[model samples]
Target: MSLLLLAPALLLVGVVFLWPLLRYAWLSGHAASVLTGLVPLANGGANWQRLLSDGRFWQDTLQTLRFAGVSLSLELLLGLALALLLHQPLRQRGAVRAAVLLPWALPTTVMALGWRWLLNDPYGPLNRLIQGLGGSPYGFLSTPATTWLFTVLADVWKSTPFVALLLLAGLQTIPPELEEALLLEGAGPLQRLWRLTLPLLAPYLLLAALFRLAQALGVFDLIQVLTGGGPASSTESLGLYAYLNGMRFLDFGYSATVMLGMFLLVLLLTSGLLLLRRGWQGTLR
Candidate 1:
């Protein structure tokens, strides 16, 4: 009966999510480019072989992984702090919490474009401030080292609130009596946080990490609008590379293969995180 109740949702999910993935998988095994008249023909692992030796694909993979790791780390850390702060009692706390979420609520393109203008060479406020301090205006968007770092920062700023909200909900579910008991036992703030709060909050942290990791790994709009994968493709994500292969180069088969590879990479990393979480729980036991 329970399975029957979920049948519609399961079917919907299959069609919406599973269908596209299956289509991509099928397309990946064929040749479907302008040279092939955009018709998919079986290529017998040719695309996969090419992917193995594709230097640019590997470079984009590294960049994407780095971006996801750094940004997700920052987001998780800052989000936990913000969640703890919001979990406290304060005047106008609802308003404050809502304000904190504004960044996450904004459309991604809007936020990315805003960052692009803010980091524009010579005219952005940051550069203006640098000039006032007697430094030459810097090309933030045109610099390789700094550009990727800023993209991570921009991603962190926008996504942290979402992680915070998830953690705050987790905090809410924590029984107050547990904390009271700890306090009566002479537990300090840090002690309670480390011993009680974090352990209980582990599931939420895992949830937030998994969600943010998927988003960060598939980051496209922000990098596209902000950097356009410029400065020698320093900040190019796998999603953007796939987009370029499909749209710019008109190679649908290779593009599909890239997308499938990205899906596998995400699956691998998230699975590893889940395994770690399970091991952690075992140790806690």
Candidate 2:
């Protein structure tokens, strides 16, 4: 009876998730492009082989990992701090949270465009400020050395609020008595956070980590709108590469292969996190 109750949801999941994955796997083995008249032709491992040898693909993969790693770390750290601040009793807490969430709530394209203008060379506000200070206007979006860093900063700025909201919920779940008891025993703020609050909040932290890791790995829109994987492709991600192959280069087969590669990478990382979650749960028991 329970299985019957879950059948519809299970079917939906298969259709929405499983089917696309299966299709990509199958398509990755074929040749489908303008050369092939846009019809899928059995290519038998050719696409995968090309992917293995493609230097650009591997470079993009590395860049994606770096982007995800750095963004995830900063977002988690800053988010925790912001969450802690919000957890305090303050005037107009609701309004404060709304303001904090504004960045995350805005459309990604809108935010990306805003950042692009802010960092634009010569005439942008940042450049104008530099010029005012007797410094040359910096080419933020054009310089390979600084472009990727700005992308990371933009991502962190937009995403940190989301992480803060998750951690704030976790903070609320913690009982006030736990902190009160620690305070009575002469425990300081940092000590109570380390010993009591953090331990209780471990599950929530892990949850947020998993969520951010997955999102960071699959980041697309921000990179697309903000950087466009520019400045000699220093910031190109696997998703952007796949997108270019499929949409720009008209290579469907290779695009499918790239998508599958990204899927495998995400699966491996998320699987590790899941294993860690299990181990943590076992330790709790």
Candidate 3:
């Protein structure tokens, strides 16, 4: 009876996940002939060889790493601060928590559009505020540096609530006695936070970081709507590049190669995260 119930899920996974992944990997290595759609080319390593020699691929990969790294770091820091703030015994804590979730709750497309409007150079509120403050209007999405900054900020705004929620859950799991013990040992508030609280929060912190890392790596809609990988491909991420190739350019063969590369990179990262998580659990035990 259990097997019967599980069969559908297993079938779904095989069909939706395993089959597509296998197809993508196969297509990545082959050339599509005009008549056959895709055929194994005689050039044994041509697809991979091309990928290796493609300067744009490496540049975009670096950009992706930078994007993910900056966004994750900022989100983790902000989320941790927000989580600690919410840990205080305040009136209207529930309302504050609900408000914090608003950005995360909004659809990505909607959030991106809202940000676009807010950051537009000529009439946007942000630039206007800067101008009012007697500073020159900065291009938030026009230049590469500015575009990256907005992308990071956008990601942080939308995702920090998730990290805070996870950290809040972890905070609740901690006993008050542990904090009291630290206080009794003559530890100051900062000491207790750094020494006692943060150490215990390591697992949750790592989990939050991993979650944000995965999401940031595959970020697309926000970047697309915000910058369109533009100001001369300055903000082109792997996801956007793949979309351009597959959808815009209709180059399925090249797109498959890019997708395969991303799949492998994400797989490696996820595997490493799992290993680290397992190690942390072992240490806890």
Candidate 4:
């Protein structure tokens, strides 16, 4: 009866997500018809072949992982700090929450544009401030390292609040009496955090990390607008590269393959991380 009742949702998933996913998977292994713009019936390993041999693809893959890893790490640390701070009893807490959420609530393109304006080489307030401090005007987007640094910073600013909100929700679930008992025993704030709070909040932290990791993997707009994948295609993520291929170069076959590979990699990594989280939770018990 449960399965029967869930039939509608299953149908919807098939039509909206699974069907298209399967169709794209099929297309990924086949060549696109040049004349008709349809997928050919014959299988062509050309797309997959290119991916295996392409150095640029490997570079983008490494950069994507690096960008996502750094940004997610920063977001988790900052978000945890914010959650801890806000969990305390304080006046004006509501106002503080609102201010913190403002950046997260803004559209991503808007945030990216704001960062771009701030990082402008010649006339940006940041550069002007540096010039006033007797420092040379820096090329924020002119190098791989600096361009990626800003990309990670921009992502962390926009995403940290989300992580905090999730963690704060988790923090709220803890009993206040436990902290009181710990205080009576002369446990310091740091001690209580390590022994009592961290064990409890680990699940939430992992959950937030997983969410951010997924978003960071497919990051496109911020880096795209900031660097246009240049100073040498150094900041080009898999999503941007696939987009350029499919739309700009009109290589639908290769683009589809890239998308499929990306999806599979994400799925595998997500599953592996979740399993690790489950094992860690078991150890905690």
* Winning model by lDDT: 1
User: Model 4 segments beyond 4 Å from truth?
Assistant: 33-41
lDDT of 1 by residue, 46-92 (tens): 99999999999999999999999999999999999999999999899
lDDT of 3 by residue, 60-164 (tens): 888888999999998889999999999999899999999998999999999999999999996899989999999998888888766888888888999999999
How well does candidate 1 match the true structure in TM-score terms? 0.97
How do the predictions measure up, each by TM-score?
0.97, 0.97, 0.90, 0.95
Pitting candidate 2 against candidate 3, the one with the higher lDDT is 2
- Candidate 2's C-alpha lDDT? 0.92
Residue 113 C-alpha lDDT in model 1: 95
RMSD of each: 1.2, 1.1, 2.6, 1.5
Native-to-model Cα distance after best TM-score fit, residue 65 in candidate 3, in Å: 0.4
Ten-residue region with minimum lDDT total, candidate 3: 34-43
By lDDT rank, best first, the candidates go 1, 2, 4, 3
TM-score between model 3 and native: 0.90
- Write down the lDDT of every candidate, Cα atoms only: 0.96, 0.92, 0.86, 0.87
